[model samples]
Target: MSEISQAGGTLGAGDRNRSLTYIFGLMLLVGFGSPAAGLVDVPITFFLKNKLHLPAHEVANFRLVAAIPLYVGFLFGFARDRWDILGRKDRGMMMVFASVCAAAYAGFAFVPVSYPMLMAAVALSAVAWSFARAAEQGLASMAGQQLAVTGWMSVIWSMAASVPYLGAYLIGGALSQALEGRTAEQAARTLFLVAAGVMGAMALYSAWKPKFLYSHLKAEAHADRPLQDLARLFRHWPVYPALAVWFLWSFAPGSGTALQFHMQNTLHASDTQWGAWNAIFAAAFIPTYLVYGALCRRFTARTLLFWGTAVGIPQMVPLYFIHSVDQAMWAAAVIGLTGGVASAAYIDLLMRSAPKALQGTIMMTAGSLYWVAIRFGDVLGTRLYEQAGGFGACVIAITVVYALIVPVLLTVPRSLIATREGEVLPLEEPALEVGAQETLHA
Candidate 1:
């Protein structure tokens, strides 16, 4: 008995050491991917739209197309679960995917002429991003035993990712100003190339240190699960309202992506000015997350959700009165803070509602639905912006929708918080089972 106790202590210490190492490694991987993504998203959305001279509706349509591959990527988790693409090496898979993503970005940067080609590049980039994202998240879940820690780690990584956007805003703005005489296309392409180079370097780092920051897991030891199983898993009574809240929250801000262009053309803001304003918007979220983490300890997730939804009321309401670029920028910054808090609270709520084994799938599904809502909202909002004859009316319409979310948020009950500690309750299985049984019965 004494000998067994001693051996168990030794193994336990080893596991702790290994888990800590994995955590740090995951942080680095997140840092690389997050910033690269941020750099690309801002330029593609704001700069590309302006450069292409695409209408808001057309831009929204293309965005919808770009997002399709992301959903497809979610399905890849099943393959990832079954196969050892990089010989069961998570870091190797991450590098391979990141490389592909970099190449796709380069294609977008250098390939000239034809909107079809641009769309193709966008699709490829989305695929690569999906591959890395699925693998990275799966690894994060495995590394941290505590869901709260995993959530906190994600928050930290996101904060790091926000750094590149700040830099990109500053640099992209300066370049746009210096190249004032250049066509919008030329400036946009140049910025894309710069982002590509940054991503390419990170890809190489991931390849060279393939084992550097990865959790040590024997691929063969883990059981495989089907990705399609997620749809069934979401049918639980609790999941329904939780997901509704997620979709509504996502749809609200998705209109903001289109609003960036409105800031430029409608408000007549310079690229440099827009960039500065975006920087403010992006930076405001960091502190809010800190507050959220602190508040989570003292309050219920439901309370946080309620307050988050209520706070958002002010965000959309103020946008109706904005006249100048400065006002628009400040409003965006305020929205960012509100959005940051709301997002943190929502994610916390989601984690509580989902089981451990299904965390990635549930989160991805929720994300997919959120993006879908955004895509839907964007299409409608763009048309409304055009039909209503100005940004003010659009703001009012979205604000009304935001107000409606309060009651929707209230629909979530306190009983569904079982997954808060990452516990996978038997009751939650009914959601997934019902979906499966329905399909089977059908």
Candidate 2:
């Protein structure tokens, strides 16, 4: 273990206690927050496919429209970094957005279900969710750098997100099936009401003041010039490679809506079975995440990065071979297992690349790219699946994209990966020009 981890933190003895509490608090935020943000996905997809009878491309278009807020997620993160809401920083931002999310859900609960109505509600919820996501991700990045535990934070974030998502997929599958008996309006009302309660709980959790977490945010320097900070962020080179890694990794031409449609229409898988496949895939990741948390402490990011990429490049290959629903379930597990280490390392690298006091901005910027890649990938994937060499073309494209990440990884600053545990990036301004003597502060 590094001295920083052994000593707990740079501050003092109290830093240990603060670090523990802060990490636990983040775990809670990400864990509950995942499903609260995503529980509507399966139902919405099903509603469009089964009820509205939309085509594959139309469904992808709907997802594209609904996810607009997520594509611009950095703006919300910039807002969080520069503006403290009601003087409570991330906590206030989370509470306020979570409440807005709940209200949106509540309003949708009573409204009649139509394609337009569903699109509007989902978009509105996504906007509210953008703010909450920024708050938590920013806080997690800050904690990871401050506590010198980027790898462990990666595990917490990945596992928390995966576990809740597993349950949400199963629950959402059952809920979608249950909605079949009701009128469209009644079904909308039922689903939205449940969504409202989830966001309400998230709001309540945000309202609780953890002194350690609150104090950490309070102690950090607030950005005085938002424009200058944004400019500085753009000039930062390490961020480019980090963001590229996320974009390329998430830009899966073989997955998202394409995979879903293939499993359902081509393989004749029922909604419940689709959900089970997702649950099984998520479950398969738990062990790898656990192992990664340990391995990250022992290995450098470079070591993990190379090995992860080697394993992760073939992630979509299994999907290309699956012809049956049963085979698809096995393929999902294989995909998840193959990608776990790379996914965690991707997150760890992004966290490490964040400039001091700009964790929110960088993390959220990366998030924005992630959603953009995913949505656009869906748009493109659907086309390729229909027009090109079927699903295999998408798989080949995804593999190619994953391979491109290796070249990009070479561009990351050496300073960022010099330590096993996270060594905080410089607090001082990074040198702007390439070949500058001080690319990173010592």
Candidate 3:
């Protein structure tokens, strides 16, 4: 018997404490990183819309810059996995990313805020965020195993991300109102500095708490060739269907600038009203987060997707008819309830399929899939809104595209699906026998 099994009933005093600390370390990096994203986004949006007087399309252009770096998530994953650290790999990178994030934000504080300047600053910040995010997600995946509850990991991450959205809406709206003229610039500068300070603190904590914070990496020592390792994944059948899910579900043809313009121009919402709608949408995620957490433990990935996607895609229908701000808020709240469920389910399934050795690569690549879909959706949504029948027309097209997720979901093999009934780790051969039926010789 393993010593662990022999000593199962009791833990040493130090061992017990260290294990507890380890749990916290796994969650801390992502928790902080998720909320920080809200801080960056809300301020940036208000800066462009209220200060610079740019249209929704222009704002989306800025978002494009912020999004582009995320497409290379595999690179970040490769770097994290390939490098050896003096301490621990994930912890070392967390500290480095936090420092870089701080520096980037600090630089943003001094730069002149113009179209080009805003794009550059936001893009730099996005790169920093990408690294920090990759590190946190890696830690989160490890933490899930330690906690013996993967569902809660998704819940915590989603909830943590939501908190900032809610706060940024209420607080950011207030900041917009209070900080006028020169103060608007000053407010942005202050927010940037605050972000820098927070990241600096994160670095300091990771450095000091390496004993607690470092991840217990379970990946094999090294691969002979990185490209071949990746190529092997591409040859795997499940990856294609999973990517299709992201692309189809997120391929909303009438969102991005279209939806924004609808809310601002058509609904005629003020800044605070617009912000309130967002805050309410985020607030609705609380209950859904809890419910999804429980559901993940009880249900299979395919089942989760069927029910989740069914309910979630239709939620957009309300947006088509939303002529008033009240209607808009209600729509957001309704979508929030189901949207959270669908999103968490998607994440749960993806993680279940992640290769043990390439956990970082698979997870980050999954993230990249989501963003790539969003970017394409944004471009399509904008053009559709302009070319089609404005908001309603675009919504209709998006709804149809979203429904196509059902067909895409069907294409994924049952062998690839993960559940409480069975796990689907990426290294496992789901392609033959278990993944595919054995063919008898004729």
Candidate 4:
């Protein structure tokens, strides 16, 4: 077993370096894939509503309909862990999946107004996204042996993905405004073509840098764990509460996507102004990640979680009184900062609570549930915002949810803290040796 020491903490330093190298390479590819996924979805929904003359409610139903395959895709994480292609590494499987995703997006971009084809494309893209996300998360865990390191990895990965979105929103807004005489379908098709190009670039990059990822693939040795056994892992004293906290935290502002229209309506901001505000919001996230990494090194994960939730309280509470575009923009920035911290802390805590081999399964399961909660909350919050006649009610609702979860988040046991000087101690030689073996296989 090899060890690397930094700041008085010993970890799989050699594997960490290897993982970082691979993660950076993989993130570059995955980053492009993410924005393509998001960008196409936006235009697809818009096309369905305005261009195809579908009802807004029917278009909203697409969200619920889409959740079916998305959840199924998440379940495929278990299969992805067990299945391999061409007797090659997990990265090879991921590359294959990425290629499939690119093809699916291209299909969506080129295919004309057939509902069945559109739905099929969405399903295929969802499945590919799920597989790629699961693989990426597992690889991140392999690279980041500790909670703090994982936080850093997630932040970097997020920043990579965010860049494309920032550009898309800004550029797409300008293009939409300049091309106002064009039909809505034309605008949507244009964006889809652009997104397809991004996905194509991602596929090319993945093919170009196969070696970096090949060395980091690992098989799931815990695949044989029974369903009950896995369920029981989360049934423990702190685990269930921790999971609940995760749900509430994610659900609180889960309506942010829905709230954009509300902001535009209330503040009377143009589409370009909204895009610029969102860009600032996304830009605000970078510093939060950096701050989170630093805080994770100095404080316990529980403490960070607590502080994150605390910071989030003010962020949501102020939404009720925001009457101007500038106020909304500032609020968005604060939400971005607090949301980033809370997310990084929550994931760090989740990773610390799971055993190494089970991390992927545990995380995938949690993420599925989290997304479900977010979906539910988004619906509820949007209804409330519509009926209540002001943003205040929505703010109150989210703030209350955040307040309730803070204590539960704080109750996460100190043992789950992965900081070396605090709770996590040096691994015994035998355990390190076994971990080394797993890394070799991975």
Predicted structure 1: clash tally: 3
True-structure RMSD, every candidate: 7.3, 5.3, 7.4, 4.4
Per-residue lDDT of 129 in model 1: 66
- Please, what are the lDDT tens digits per residue for candidate 3 over residues 1-442? 0111111132233443464344344344443443224566666677788788887676766676677887787777766655545445566777788889888889888876667776776677767767766766765664343233355566676676677668777777667666765655577687778777867777776565433212222323336688866776667676677666766776776655677677878888876787788788888977887788677657766787789888878867878778799899999888788678777666665555555445567667777776777776776777777777688887787778878878878877775555442132334532212110011100
Report the backbone clash tally of model 4.
2
Off by over 4 Å in 1: 1-37, 45-51, 71-73, 77-83, 87-92, 107-109, 141-147, 150-154, 157-170, 177-193, 201-238, 411-442
Score each candidate by Cα lDDT.
0.57, 0.77, 0.64, 0.59
Question: In model 1, which residue pairs have backbone atoms overlapping below 3 Å?
Answer: 25-213, 232-432, 233-432
Cα lDDT of candidate 3 equals 0.64
- Candidate 1 lDDT over 1-442, as tens digits, reads 0111111122233444444455445444433333223454555555446566777788788877777866544365433433445553445556677777777767677666356765676677677766666556555543332323333443543455455556567665666567667765575477556656655665565454323222222222223345345544545456667677777776653355457667777788877887887677768777877676566555655676778778866666667777898797778678778766676766655545554345455555665676677777888777777777666666776777677778877677666542322232223432222111112211
* Prediction 1 global C-alpha lDDT: 0.57
Which scores higher on TM-score, 2 or 3? 2
**Clash tally, candidates in order:** 3, 0, 2, 2
| TM-score to true structure, per model | 0.76, 0.90, 0.84, 0.82
Put down candidate 2 lDDT per residue, 121-232, tens digits, no spaces: 8888888877887888887887677667788788878887787678767987888887788788887787777777877777787777654433333235544677778777
Q: Give lDDT for model 2.
A: 0.77
Q: Which numbered prediction scores highest in lDDT against the true structure?
A: 2
Please give, for residues 1-442, the per-residue lDDT of candidate 4 as tens digits: 1454433235454555555665766665565455323555544544464456664235545655665555544365555555555444345556677777777766676666466766666666777766766666665654454423655665565576566556656765566566567865466567656655666665555444333333333333543555744554545455566667777776764244446556666677776776677677777777887788667657766677778777866666656767899898887777677777776776666655655454455566666766676656666666666666545676788888877876786567766653632233322121322322234433
